[model samples]
Target: MTNLPKIGKPATNALNTINITTLEQVAQLDEHNLAKLHGMGPKAIGILKEALLEQGLSFSQLDEDLKNVKFTVLGDLKCDNAPKRRIIRDIVIASIVGDEKCLTEWLTDDLV
Candidate 1:
């Protein structure tokens, strides 16, 4: 992702006055504190908020109540002792032919 433009002197002074620096700091500012800063009225604050959302990272503390994640593979029968060299050769052929079904079936089988 692209970096945010450096906050200019005016913006920096405004942020420092309100005790904000990083995007995380800006994310935590409430409207009341934001409004008090020079050159940081509603429109500027809205722009900053939009930039944060675009980056897909948030400054909010994560919830401890969130569940742990686990991963599992599903759907296939498999040979217990398949030959890796043969499988690799089949995959190459299937890929060259653009054989989706063959490729999927081969991949879904457990790799030996």
Candidate 2:
């Protein structure tokens, strides 16, 4: 699971029960189904979401939201008040590349 943070024993057992021991499985998980699992809770789901997001993964329900904001940061980077030109240039290049994995992680980037 790539060392998930704040995954308690209870959540661990619950995930294990459902054969979800890896981050990949969790990435494909629907939030609703996860919430229905025994021992799962809002906090556990939040932790799972954070963990998935770290790998550029998200619940299927967030697909629209994620796509809607894909270019938002790119727009911000073009603004006059944007950060360093080099960083912006790299991001723009990455965007032009149009790689889904790259964009997913970079579009929502924060200070590294």
Candidate 3:
């Protein structure tokens, strides 16, 4: 399994303050609900989004990557504010390119 990003104190505190702790909970929140939290500003939301991306996860795309299977970020090609779509595209490209093994190695490398 991929290592989940460390939820920093600020983010954790913000989540606790808003009573959101699990991935499922994060997945359930809409932008409006997230914006309602005390310390979860736009920047914090972006950080959380990045964390999810690093784990090959997103609120809407979580179902695509099953826990029983392994996956990795072969590439992250997207402009700003479109991480979810970028992930989806990259995953599709990975499948088509048949580079899952290389992706797994790259992801396992600490340099990546």
Candidate 4:
């Protein structure tokens, strides 16, 4: 969501804490749940909804057979284990693709 023009660091950090770490994830969340996240305020929610609308989408459209979106990771973490690499790869792909259920199934630790 950092790409969203009006969202500030606080709101971005808040969403990140809950593992809502992708723009696709933001679009999949209901406004009610989005409001409940500690750092999400009314203004942020409005900004998010408007951003989603600009994509020709809304929160409700996450289930519309959307494919996994491709993105490049820009960090120094190295994964030598093939299995772990694949798992991380799949989850990242799912996050990009707006696979809420897949993300939920795999990354449930520390979720609120």
Q: Judge candidate 4 at residue 7 and give its lDDT.
A: 79
Query: Tens digits of per-residue lDDT for model 2 on 1-112?
Result: 4655668888988888766677777776667657767788899899889888988888657344344333422122334664567556666666656666756665674746
TM-score quality measure for candidate 2: 0.50
State the TM-score for model 1: 0.38
What is the full ranking by TM-score, best candidate first?
A: 2, 4, 3, 1
Q: List ranges where model 1 is wrong by over 4 Å.
A: 1-8, 57-112
| lDDT-superior candidate, 1 or 3 | 3
**What's each prediction's clash count?**
0, 0, 0, 1
lDDT for model 2: 0.68
Residues 1-112, model 3: lDDT tens digits? 3332455667667677655666655765554446555566777777667866666666544333333334323222434468756656655666656779755644454742
Model 4 segments more than 4 A misplaced: 61-112
Better of 1 and 2 by TM-score: 2
Summarize candidate 1's per-residue lDDT along 1-112 as a digit string, tens digits.
3444355567667776545556765655554445556676566666666777877644344234321212111111243365775676667657755789979988875855
Q: Per-candidate TM vs. native? A: 0.38, 0.50, 0.39, 0.48
Candidate 1 colliding pairs: none
Q: Local distance difference test, per candidate?
A: 0.56, 0.68, 0.57, 0.66
Residue 69 lDDT, candidate 3, scale 0-100: 38
Q: What C-alpha lDDT, on a 0 to 100 scale, does residue 112 get in candidate 1?
A: 55
**Candidate number that wins on TM-score, 2 or 3:** 2
Query: Model 4, range 3-95, lDDT digits (tens) per residue?
Result: 554677888877777666666777666565566666778888788888887876577443334323232332223545687677787788787
Off by over 4 Å in 3: 1-10, 60-112
